[model samples]
Target: MFNLVVEMNTQKIRKDFPVLEKGIIYMDSACVSLKPQQVVKAMNCYYNEFPACAGRSMHKLGEKVTEEVSKARKIIAKFFNAKPNEIVFTKNTTESINLVANSLGLKKGDKVITTDKEHNSNLLPWQNLAKRGIIHEIIKSNEDNTFNMDKFKEKIKGAKLVSMVHTSNLDGVTIPAEEIIKIAHEHGALVLLDAAQSVPHKEINVKKLDVDFLACSGHKMLGPSGTGILYGKYHLLEKLEPFLIGGDTVIDTTYTTAEFEKPPEKFEAGLQNYAGIIGLAEAARYLMKIGRKNISKHETELNKKITNELLKIDGIKIIGPEDPELRSGIISFNYKDADPHEIALLLDSSADIMVRSGAHCVHSWFNAHNLKGSARVSLYIYNTEEECDKLIEEINKIVEL
Candidate 1:
């Protein structure tokens, strides 16, 4: 087996996550990653030092909060190669996508295209828009659950917006986003990417992709929960109406009328999660330092090891593409006639291995395929070869029963 644990400095990385000391193997990063001590300390610094509202208070504490929050915004923007003013902070990826769905002002008969393999966050918003007379179209995937470019091309004829998941949490397949975005633009359609899974494991430059809008959760990237970002081009953000309007969203207001703040500020309403923002920025910095390319390589190596071993077991059915490279760091599979939840329980109880089960918020895909669910093992930078071995050993034992 390849020894990437040392090459990736995974032991040193594990030291930053205190939860790893508990002797548990965590392979569920697709849902929420374990926050490092650096992120926690950054958040603690915010609460303990400033503990004041940003852009609202005029006192020293407020000024400090505002400065720190501004810095956090710039850090996050740089992480995605976006302009500072283009970044809008929201509660999570769901809220970010919802903001676009509500603010984009899609009129009756306007067409929006998405893939059949989308997470519910990317799917439901357009479905709700359909209720208001928008035409929602779902392009079905290939037999192997890969994106069908031919189908997408056929559907993109008159689409108003094309919102798709960059990397699927269900099976870890990353669509060809850069090409897709280019084609959508040629068709005079705006593209919004649900990057909740991609941003954490891969390098994504919004400027490079030329995608109109992108949404991702900080919690999935070793940051704090309740922190996420919506990135849009400055001009587009200026044209779209605010999703949630109140307090910080406006510059000044009369009883009858209100003058709103610019792009980002207008979109970010109410008192924000100051501590979480600080933590999320620190998380971005940490990931940058480690290098997303190296992280992707490390996870792919681990996934290769796990996928090869799992395929050796009889009655094991792997999901998505057969190639581990295409699936990134996720291995989702089912044993014949086995309940995925029961398999998850067995792994947790017998080996202290934490994995995800069920449809992983892609219930529509499961229903379409007539499947119940599958156990998912998702890897991250901190995961090691030893842990992968342990997972394989435990899964082998479970299959025997």
Candidate 2:
């Protein structure tokens, strides 16, 4: 159903993001998205109009802040087709996954399976569990970077949990999340999806995916930084223990013993990011208005257009899957005898193009494959065909020189 490619009004959509008018071609949405004016204004209203703590003070401003926070939670919950209480606020995707890893109560010799394509956020959490006597098993992809479902099926046996990245930042490879989730459930293993890369660009229904836990960041999806969400089924959340304690996380506490709050409140500790959360709600609303399916189609078309032109260069090499249809909005490439960092600098200085280079926080994957990093170009709803043409024109100029 998601494979359908529809057209988007790029010129009209571009007006929503103020940064696009600066003549800078931003292709780094995978790192962090450009926030729309609506999102920024939402945050400003939180600080300027109602500058009060939620659920703490009894003043009118505090009451308004509490209502806004509750409304924001419902908005985010509806965005992912999840219950409001199932959503837990976090610092970012890194903290969200760590919360799951530490709270899962892994025991000595319990097996946890993951893939080689995972970003450091998903990979490091499971690896850290090894110090606690948990066994971390990694499933390697094929030489062509395609997932080997047979290998995944073989390793999922007797596994306590299966964690995977829904979409890859390294190469824009989108995994078969539904198929993977089905296999993990059959083996009686809990599944967690790192949706930081996928959720921003496409639609993800947690109940439909049937994932035990899912993590994504607000900053990567057009909200403010230092805000994220961890969605867990109520039953699973009740079974897992809370990693952080004290403050509002507990309903009551004594010096000797404490009674923690339920589900989300139990996971969330200390003062929350009120402004960022409100901004994130506005961001979700903005994306919802645009339609996730349409955004996906627009990004895929842009990636294909740029990739087709890049392939015509003699020394150019595309990373990850060969087909543009199989990838997300990200496209990574490297040239013969040219350093990726130098090429990126040239693009930034010469054309004011913004792109990311180097390991992209997947250093272990690059080291395992015995290769250097590549330059990456990621797109979003605000990007345009003219920007793509300019990027290609500059790259071709480099090749000729």
Q: What would the per-residue lDDT of candidate 1 be over residues 1-401, giving only the tens digit for each residue?
A: 33484446888899999999999999999999999999999999998999999999999999999999999999999999999999999999999999999999999999999999888999999999899999999989998889999999999999999999999998889999999999999999999999999999999999999999999999999999999999999999999999899889999989899999998999999999999999999999999998999888999889999999999999999999978999999999999989999999999999999999999999999999999999999999889999999999999999987
- Residue 401 of model 2: what lDDT? 71
Model 1 off-target regions past 4 Å? Answer: 1-7
TM-score (all chains, Cα) for each model: 0.99, 0.97
The parts of candidate 2 lying over 4 Å away from their true place are 1-7
Which candidate has the highest TM-score of all? 1
The lDDT of each candidate is: 0.94, 0.89
Q: Please give, for residues 143-232, the per-residue lDDT of candidate 2 as tens digits.
A: 767777989988999999998888889888888999999989999999999999999989999999999999999999999999999999
> Once model 2 is optimally superposed onto the true structure by TM-score, how far is the C-alpha of residue 89 displaced, in angstroms?
0.9
Report the Cα lDDT for candidate 2. Answer: 0.89
